[model samples]
Target: MFRFLVGRLLILIPTFIGVSLLAFFPIRLLAGDPVALLSGERVMSPERHAEISHQLGLDRPYIVQYLDYLWKILHGDFGVSISQKQPVLDQFFQLFPATLELSLCAIIFAIIIGIPAGILAAVKRGSFLDQLVMGTALIGFSMPIFWWGLLLIILFSGILQWTPVSGRISLMYFFPSVTGLMLVDSLLSGEPGAFKSAVSHLILPTIVLGTIPLAIIARQTRSAMLEVLSEDYVRTARAKGLSTFRVVGVHALRNALIPVVTTIGLQVGVMLAGAILTESIFSWPGVGKWMVDSVSRRDYPVIQGGLLIIAGLVMVVNLIVDLLYGLINPRIRH
Candidate 1:
């Protein structure tokens, strides 16, 4: 177990470095000159541009700038947001709960719906039910988040008027941000309908954010279940006259979870990436939308820092998943 954890931790170093390289150099290069992007509509004087560039150390060689950025990262200094003029970490922490809230809700939503659907489909393999599950999974997997969100908004928000079109909650509610999660904070406020309001606003975003992961989990779980159902242990359990639930859910599903867990783990990263679009579409005040806003404003420090922080989060989740995987199926530890 120790060895497994150590191995996973060791992998994070190079993975994080890769994330840094991808997050830094490519974005800085392909996004055009930061100074120019920051200028927006009005053309700025060349002198002002050079001054801003020098102030931002854009005047230095690209390698030097990158190394300096890495040095700052090592020192736990992600730098201040040029647009917000606040420390990146400060803003990150303040805003992270929103993203965290969205991500958690999305993943939970996925797991709750996905696992059951997968199990059902697997139990009825090669039937119409299985075909339906797989077909729906394919459609869910293929649907673009932004388009899906808009479609939901049109149907639910615009046409039906069932859910809010945008924002984390209604403007009427005000509560102390005890946990930064709207649901908790709203309950803490003891205000009427606050919790319900929070849940309502969360519904659309969660569905939109979770759709792909749900699809992936469903497919992965079904595949894993099918494989495990044919295993010797499962067959023996069935032969022993164990109940259908015990044979399938206990013997088969338990073993099948290894791959499903891996799929869920990988989905965490995808969830975060999807949150970027989901938040934008919903105008949720989370890190994803913040990152998008930062991009428009050309806040390079925020962009780089946010990317690193998000990458680090994904790494942490993956590590936890690896550890869980090892515990559940010890064969992997070897």
Candidate 2:
């Protein structure tokens, strides 16, 4: 296991390098210059443009710039955001926790809602409850995150006033900046009021982000359970006088979870990367919002840094999923 993990970790260097190589030149290849865009063409003179370019190291040859970027990356210097005038690493770390918190909540929400609904749907296939659960899953899968978030905000926050319309916490409650995750910080500070507000604000965004993954897990679980529940071992367990629940729950669901686990792992990365729209809608100050803001301003460092982090996360999660497959099945370890 150690050897396998080391091998996989070793491959990440080249993967990151390839990502940088592909992404670096594209900004210049595109129609506009980053410096020109930041310093508007209307008021900027030739010398000012030259200064901006020099500051960004755009005046150097592409190869030199690429080598410098790679070297700085090795030394944990993600470069300064051309627009924000802050270190890219600082900006990334500052906002990443919020997104991580949001994504964790979203995944929990997906699992709690999706897995059981799927099991029930598979257990009672062709029944009204089965149809109902599957139908809900279908709707969730079909709807867009932005649309779902809007509808939820309108119904729960706007009309009913059950939750906050936007933001991480209420203006009334004070939360410490310890963790950058408002909910955790609020709890640590023993502020139930702030925690509640943070949770309430989280509801709409989490639901919108979770919907697709929930639907996917539901469908995959249903299929997996359907297959496992009909296997010879299930019949053998039932024939040996095992309780129906034992036969299904212990024998069937345990094995069925392998595929479901894979889906969950993949969806974790997706939810993290795809939260841009949800974050924008809910005004959540997460990585997604940071990426969007950076992109709009042509902040190459932030854009590249964010994308690099996301890619690394996705690769790590995939590696975890691969290892988990062997642990769960016990068949692939050989």
Candidate 3:
């Protein structure tokens, strides 16, 4: 297990380098030059352009600039965002936690809703309940997140007035800002009102972000369960007079979870990507929205940092899922 982890960690270096190279040159390929973009109208003067280029090290050869960027990355420096004028890494740390929280909540929502629905659908097979579950999953899979978010906002927030429309908390709450995550900070500050509002804010976005993954997981779980249900072990359990629930739950579902686990891991990354749209709709101030704004302004550092962070997260999740297979089914570990 240690060997596998070390191997996976080592692979990140080259993978990150490749991603950075792709991110770096694309900015250069854009319609305008970085120096001009930085200096704005002032760069219209040739002398000013030269000064701006010198300040930003654009005067260096392309290879030199690339090497310098890589060197800084090795030293844990992601450079500053040209637009925000703040350290890119600093911005990433500040915003990534919110995105992480949103992704986690969505995945948790997916698994809690999806796995049971899948199990029930598989167990009931051709029953009306099975059809109902499958129909719900279909609708979830077909709907785009932004549209769903809007519909949810209209129905839940606009019409019923059950939930707040935007922001992480109600303006009235005075919670401590420890981690910038309202739930955590609210609990730390002993502010129940803030906690409630935070949870309320999370629900709509989480549901919208979770819907597609839940549908996928449900389908995968149903298929996997069905396959396992017919296996000899399941039949043996039934022949041994094991309760139907035990035979299905202990024998079939456990074995079926291997693929479900993989899907759940992959879904974490998907949820993060989907949060871009969801966050924009709800004004959630997470890494996703930050990435979108950076892209619009051509803030290369933020864009590159955000992409690298997300890609790194996905890779880590995949590796963890691979290791989980070994633990869950010991045969795979060897």
- Which candidate tops TM-score? 1
- lDDT by residue (181-251, candidate 3, tens digit) is 76788778886577888899899988989999999999999999999998998899999999988988898
Q: In every candidate, how many clashes are there?
A: 0, 0, 0
Better of 1 and 2 by TM-score: 1
Off by over 4 Å in 1: 31-33, 36-43
Which wins on TM-score, candidate 1 or candidate 3? Answer: 1
* lDDT to native, each model: 0.91, 0.86, 0.85
182-251: candidate 2 lDDT, tens digit per residue: 7889888886577788888888888889889999999999999999988999889989999978887889
Any idea what lDDT model 1 has?
A: 0.91
Q: What tens digits encode model 1's per-residue C-alpha lDDT throughout 1-334?
A: 8878888889999998888888788776555677887677889999999999899898998889889999999899999888678999999999999999999999999999999999999999999999999999999999999899999999999999999989877899887789999988998999998899999999999999999999999999999999999888888888889999998878888888889988999998899899999999999999999999888777888999999999998889889888888888789899
Model 2's number of clashes is 0
Model 2 lowest lDDT segment of ten: 23-32
lDDT of 3 at 190: 80
How many angstroms is residue 331 displaced in model 3 relative to the true structure, after the best TM-score fit?
Answer: 4.3
Those runs of model 3 whose alpha carbons end farther than 4 Å from true positions after fitting are: 1-14, 31-44, 59-64, 330-334
Task: Tell me each candidate's TM-score.
Answer: 0.95, 0.92, 0.90
